[model samples]
Target: MTTAETTGGTTAGVLAARQRSAELEELIRKDPGRFRVLTGDRPTGRLHLGHYFGTLHNRVRLQELGVETFLIIADYQVLTDRDVAERLDEYVEDLVLDYLAAGIDPERTTIFAHSAVPALNQLLLPFLSLVSVAELGRNPTVKDEIAQSRQSAVSGLMFTYPAHQAADILFCKANLVPVGQDQLPHLELTRTIARRFNDRYGNGAAPVFPEPDALLSAAPLLLGTDGAKMSKSRGNAVSLAATADETARLIRGAKTDPERHITYDPAARPEVSSLVLLAALCLGRDPRDVAADIGDKGAAALKATVTEAVNEHLAPIRDRRARYAQDLGYVRRILRDGNEIANEVAQATLDDVRAAMKTLY
Candidate 1:
């Protein structure tokens, strides 16, 4: 279904996605080699707890399942709505460190930067032609991004975000993409582009690309300490690389309601409930159960509980991060190796694209 037609995030939509996810999981469990997964993040800043729970953990799980995984750093995408290129290199390395610390093995998953793969970017030219300006404008994910960026006039890159993302997925011929509900529209656009490209250019030959399916993550959206969606730009996120003291300080300052009695009412008291939710996610307990355990304990006890749970859960990851941080050369080499592999894959895909389109002279 097209993004315009489907009611994204509705009960029905989520149910459908869950069903598909179940089927995909079974397929991967039985024969992981049958799928290739493409997933990534824009290196806007250091990844936070939201990244860890929402997507990073899943990437590691898929890799351990023996699936071929391609993780793009999306460095070029940083210019889409904001210009934080000054710290681009630092942010990219931080992402690599976070990935490694979070258990994304470079030996199993190919981790590369978008700017480092030329043929991948080259595919954007033909991809742009297959999509429409209106469709791109109507994309819910693009609309949300523009709203969040608060740009008065959207840049060309921002306008073409979906098509560029399509290129990112299709370049490696990846058959699966890990995503959250909000990202479903963007993935649908990628599917549309792949279908159109094959219909127009395949000319009865074997299709050059797979219409990738979403391996939907079951993790709930993690709220920042400030009770809003976790975001690095907002200064509310707890980075995976944050020191234990820093994490404690941040959670201690989190915005909780003045009410001494705490309960899990996300609608009524989002701040208090967010803290409760964080503790629950870390504790592997239901939010209601966690809330009940902290019954009438007030915000101080809640924050303390959350702080301890977060730190304890992250202790091992932090140790690994510290070790990886000391070896900058090794980290850079991992990126270099990933970029080499990506370049090779992208070239082969581009060659097929050219052949399918009869553009080979």
Candidate 2:
């Protein structure tokens, strides 16, 4: 989806995007400085390669830079469009293991499930009042989600996910949010809601929340083996839990163009380009460079190369995930400890919000 479709056909994204600096990413690269960041993913399943290079990898890097990072396992977000009533616990557990396997340190980063943070959810009640149905419906990100989920009757929760996201961002008082090109509109909505809340209620002394800026990642959009969007629900994604043989089989079966000579033109050959992007991510090289290396090599060679590179890269992650899976007790403890820390921060933010609005009575 373009900015037109993603930003709800408004200039809100174009305007708010001015503050989102690629320079900030460069700055972080050079100095490794500290900033408070709030970023997360819905606990639908084990994160795939789309996640590793997209967001989860960035989360680990940010934490290592001493930046105060909060990783939210948005378990509640799963219910926004679909029902995970039976598999919610299994989903949450697998997500936590994926976090650990991907190197998200529980000691350094507070990785809490959204449902575990009651105070955070409570903040959503007041935040819901701050944004209207029109405003929420106009959210391009939400609209795109509703469309993708194929839900004709949009749920109230799905409609107001941006507001819930605003609550998530503001509750942590985050100043930097690491996101991709697709998430800019949602982040812009968070900024709008934060400014709206502060202007209305925090005009007296101090603003309660700082509008967070997008810390753009270096990775591009990763497509699944089928050259479509990488998603578990679609059954096209390469799971982080996939063994070497499984990964190889998936890559071997991936879609590629009929061209005899491989090239990296996403518009012309999206299938090959998707594999090119994946290769670049796995080996940390330019996609164009990878394309050149596969010169004269046919589709078979291209798939073989991608299969080898991906398996080599994900081997350690899969191993670590297996180790974490064995110790479910340890994983539960990590979540519990993270919940305590997250609650403290969330409750403090909610208390401040109540006091600012004078709704504490």
Candidate 3:
């Protein structure tokens, strides 16, 4: 089977398994009052389409559900691979701007930079001691990162990233983690650590960490204009903050097939199919219906149609972002308030954790 077939089959199998798993029963048993969700982005670059569809859009939905959400700017995770940490401050600031511009309400949600929270880092040390080095090596995310980087040399911090991630979730006592299918292992590891810590230290007291479960999203995986993965490094990603002219230029230059007529056969014509997907997402129409409406239109006409649809879709978001970008002080104030809220919650969790371990006086 081809890569696409393999991916499709795996997704189907996972869906079938999920339908049978006692997920609903477990959810009821946990009964987390209101979902305390923890999800975050690494401060490596500006948010792009993959980030938007894969997580950010769902985050907006979760927030609307009245779930208590905490968005972390994973600044320290940048050190896992990138050597230079000098410009990290600026990178984190830009990330905060991106979140605000994308409609993540500072008033309703807590947002904080990872490095700014000392308690979260402190939790990491004990969390690391709880898990073994060999176990960390077995984490699927760690393996993927190593393969992606193709690095002969790996850092100890990089190797233990899952533990740090566990710290991020456990430090907030988050009970719901919105994640894609690929991140199930991370959630499992977090649950394992929580169970181990509670068993080891509970001593008739409440558990220090709440085991978080994946709140799976049904969002589609958006592909880049180049028909590859939607990523910044590939130069195919359209930025959330892209200007109107830049957006148009990228759409026009996007790769399409040699056929004079446009159709939405993803398997046969991936490039045209990709454009159709983009147009459907932008216009909130079905891809098949959009393809049919464009019937005999050539690729040029299709490109024009897709461009108009996208620009219309992004115009409001762009305007909102511009307004927020103009007031640097307002953004800073939002982050400051958000940081305070997150820090209070994180410190409370850490204090509980320390007390459980008999380290707190």
Candidate 4:
């Protein structure tokens, strides 16, 4: 195909995704109970603003809308690249704390870790059989993960990451997953596996799984303080757990352009524009308007603007976080209850799978 054809096709795909997402939002608003969402994070470390606005905030919104939500900690997946077992316990609890602080209600959502649910992990075995080695490798997300990890070779879990995610989604029979454009490929793989599984085993009856659709986030990617993608390892992220003073200090040191005149041209001034964008997200305004508000202000003034907005926005969440931190036992109970619920649901799904395949004793 010609370059024009490829570009046109890509543009069409993006437009279609955006339309579907809008439709899904409408459906969720009308009858949120009809949708089940399976989305999560790897407990590698603290949750940052990128995570809060990019996905966490959406999770809370969905739960409040009465959607059946399942949040997996993805504790086992953390070992796919590195060994952080020493702090794994701490990290898991920290994630729960952040979730609560960010308004994730345990009463409304199911928050669990797979390591505590054997049946959920057991789904991985059958899921692996439904996918091919080449298909797994073709997943762009897995390829990027392998490349980024810089490992001499990919581990089995790393190679089968997509299938693992499929199990995570399918076990709960989730019909909607919140994701970014980059993560569309992962959801596609999950949809493919769900279709293939039903084709192979459904025997002209009810399908065993629902192919989940992508609820693409409307939020733009929040960049790090250094003008790069916000990441925990890069040390550019503003952690939700950070104190008010710490948040101010981090934003104060954020990178910005040398130009005295502030603007929100991301293509040309990524660093400055990113700070403006962050402040804009907190203030619920357009980045360009935020820039216009800071016209002629130097980077110092821009940084100050961001610092104040971010801290003011996060004050309530941090207050909630500190109060929750005082009782780790309550956090632990939430995880425990979520695990019990997950095990029940996963066992029921696994039984259905066995029955569909006629493998049940």
The best candidate by TM-score is 4
For 1-361, candidate 3 gives per-residue lDDT tens digits of: 1111222125663464355233632553455346688999887677876677677877776676567889999988987865556577776777777787777998778988888888888888888888888888888788888777634677777888999999999888988777767776677678788888999999978787777766666667667888787786688878878987988898888888788767788889888888888888888899899888887878888888888988887787778878888888887788788778878888898889878888877
Local distance difference test values of all predictions, in order: 0.89, 0.82, 0.78, 0.87
Q: Which has the better lDDT: candidate 2, or candidate 4?
A: 4
* lDDT value, candidate 3, whole model: 0.78
Question: What lDDT does candidate 4 reach at residue 44?
Answer: 84
| Residues 1-361, model 2: lDDT tens digits | 2222235234565444434455666667676545788888887777798888888888898888878888898888887887444488998898899899999999899989898899999878878887788988877777777887756676778887888898888888998888766777778778777877889998677899887777656667778887788887888989899888888889888988778798999888888999988887898888899999998888888888898889988989989999989999999999999999999999999999989889889
Query: Residue 55 of candidate 4: its Cα lDDT?
Result: 92
TM-score of each predicted structure versus truth: 0.95, 0.92, 0.89, 0.95
Give the per-residue Cα lDDT of candidate 4 at 36.
94
Query: lDDT value for candidate 1?
Result: 0.89
How do these models rank on TM-score, best leading? 4, 1, 2, 3
Q: Report RMSD (Å) for each prediction in the order shown.
A: 2.0, 3.2, 4.6, 3.1
Model 3: residue 226 alpha-carbon error in angstroms? 1.6
TM-score of model number 4? 0.95
lDDT of 1 by residue, 218-289 (tens): 876678888777898899988888988999999998989889887999889888888888888888988899
Per-residue error for 119 in candidate 3, Å, reads 0.3
Candidate 3 stretches with Cα past 4 Å from truth are 1-13, 20-33, 150-152
Task: Sort every candidate by lDDT, greatest first.
Answer: 1, 4, 2, 3
Per-residue lDDT value at 181 in model 1: 83
